[model samples]
Target: MRIGLYATGQAGLEGIVEDIAAAERLGLDSAFLPQLTAWDALTVAALAGPRVPRIGLGTAVVRTYAQHPLALAGQALTAQAATGGRLTLGIGPSHREIVEGGYGLSYDRPARHVREYLQALRPLLRGESTDFRGETLSVSGTVDVPGAEPPPVLVSALGPVLLGIAGELADGTVTVWAGPEVLGEYVVPKITDAAKRAGRPAPRVVASAMLSVTADPDRVRADIRGRFGTAGEFASYRRLLRQQGKAGLEDTVAAGDEDFVAATVARFAAAGVTDLLVSPVGTDEERERTLAFAARLR
Candidate 1:
């Protein structure tokens, strides 16, 4: 499996770039940036792409509701050009709370929204003009970015319907808070089957997990829970945890000694994950240790 660093962009824009460079030096496959409230992920990829030379630069996801397909396509293509064809664009319709409460956009019929979003977005990325009209989205335009190849697109698909949409329309799926059991028994099989039915190549399964290599694993886990416990309250994540026979977000974290951490990562690979994005957790020293150990896996 390909191992990548999940750069949170917590240390600022330059810090993010520096992290990407460090990941490349460590022989990691990719460095994925998240689309939070701060820095724009695509813009960061464009900036880091030139500096980091060889490693893949990607977005863990950019929320689909925020940008129109035409605009997103243009920006993504620009980033792709800037990155010299080394950008993977991951997009998703984030949860209702963030969309409705934060962005003030209705989150009804998310599956339909994603399906239409892809219908319009994909063709535009390929440098083809798109004229698509659906219940949720409509577009009539093309994105022209010279020397930019169409980057592979991945969707954050959790449920079955969205999985089908992702498999048929996008290249693959990106997931979070899903354990090996859910990946092996539910997610992988469901998306793979959808891709087969659509006559597409095998889909990529990119899983993100919080990991730490620490002597006091329980303390690390407690810290993770304190910081990210709200993630377990999200409906989608709650369902995923239940599917994995887990109770909360902390339960999904891989925090332990070197051997235990290695075993945890191995389980994810054994479950057929194509890419693993490790979000190192705990103290500064432990996080660095975690990244070093993950680099060896690559």
Candidate 2:
């Protein structure tokens, strides 16, 4: 399985770029940038693309409700050209809280919205003009991006409907919070079967988790719960946690010393994860130690 790092939610671009460079130096496979309230993901990838040479670049996800598919396709193609065609465009319809509250857009029928969004997005990324029209979205144009081949597209699909869509159209799904049991029992089978029926290649499963190498597991769990408790309020995340038999985000975290952490990652690999994105959590020293050990995994 390929190992990578989540390179977002940090302080600044310079540091994130440096961290990605450091990860590449450590022989990690890729660096995934998140699209939150911070700097734009594609822009960061563009800036860091030339800086880090060997590692692949990805957006953990850029919310689809905010950006049009054609606009995002242009930016993604540019990033692909800048990065020497090492860009994975991950897109999703984010949670209702972010869609309605953050962007002031109506979060109505998100599944349909994403389905139609991909209907327009897939062809544009492949340098083909889109003349299709759907109920929720309609776009009739093409983006000309020279020297830009189609970059792989991954969808942030946690539930069944979205997973089906991702398996059929996109490269795969990028997940957070869902663990081995969820992946093996729910995610892998559904997506794989969908892809097979669609006559598409096997879909990728990029699983991300909050990881920490710590002697004091209780303290880390408590800290995670205190910091990210709001994640439980989201319906999708809450459902995922419930599937794992947890009520809070902290309980879903993978934490322990070297042996335990290694075993947890192994479980994910056995569950059919193609790429594992490690989101290190803890103090500076803890994070450094975690990265050092994770580098050894590569």
Candidate 3:
């Protein structure tokens, strides 16, 4: 497994920056930056880029409702240049609450929007002018991005339809809260089937989630509950988890021991996950434990 860490939502960018060097030193593969209220993904990527050497960088899921696809492609390509080409842009049309309620953006026809976005975005990244029209978007101008290499796009696809879309159009797919066992039985088959049908080369799958471990597993679970508390109180989170048979295990992070954590991560790799993202609680002791566990894996 290519093990890495999630920038704990509770940890500010500065805290994540503080941890990056240690993360790389411990030989964890990379760190995933999440887009949230207090932080922006691009800024975080820039600040942390020069600080960590050769450590992979990614956005767990940047909300697509905030910008046009062409614009997003330009931004990511520019950032990749700044990072000497070490950025992965993971994107999706975020949920209704953030898109509709928070951003006042329409959530209708999201899958169509994503398809349109990718169509325009891909050609633009390859230094070609684009004039494409789709149900959700239309662009008729040059969108050349100099010094921007083709960064692998990992789509946030949890269901069959989107998984098929990812296989057809993107380089990879990312899943969170979808356990590895579930992946083997469900997610992988859909993506592989789609890829085979499309005659595309094999695509990558990156799976991630919260997993806790400590001398006191109870305390670790409590920490997970506290960190993901907001997720628990929501109907959306419940529905998202239930959609994958993970509703009750939203607290899996809270109950896991080191063995549990390791086993969960191992399951993801065994299930063909190219990247396994681990969200450790944002505590010094917890971080230390995670690093130690990661070192043992190394």
lDDT of 3 by residue, 1-298 (tens): 6887777545566877877667777788888888767777866776788888688888878887787767777788877776778888888877777788899878887788887888887787777788998887787666556777867888888767788888888888887767776678878888888888888888888887765556666676665666566655444456656766654544545334677767766777789888887776535677677656855664
Could you give the candidate ranking by lDDT, starting with the highest?
A: 1, 2, 3
Badly placed stretches (over 4 Å) of model 1 are none
**Steric overlap count per candidate:** 0, 0, 1
Report the alpha-carbon TM-score of model 2 versus the true structure: 0.98
Off by over 4 Å in 3: 229-240
Clash pairs detected, candidate 3: 221-254
Alpha-carbon local distance difference test for all models? 0.92, 0.90, 0.74
Better of 1 and 3 by TM-score: 1
The residue-by-residue lDDT of candidate 2 on 70-125, one tens digit each, is 89989999999999999999899999999999889999999999989988999999
Q: Ten consecutive residues with minimal summed lDDT in candidate 3?
A: 247-256
| Pairs of residues clashing in candidate 1 | none
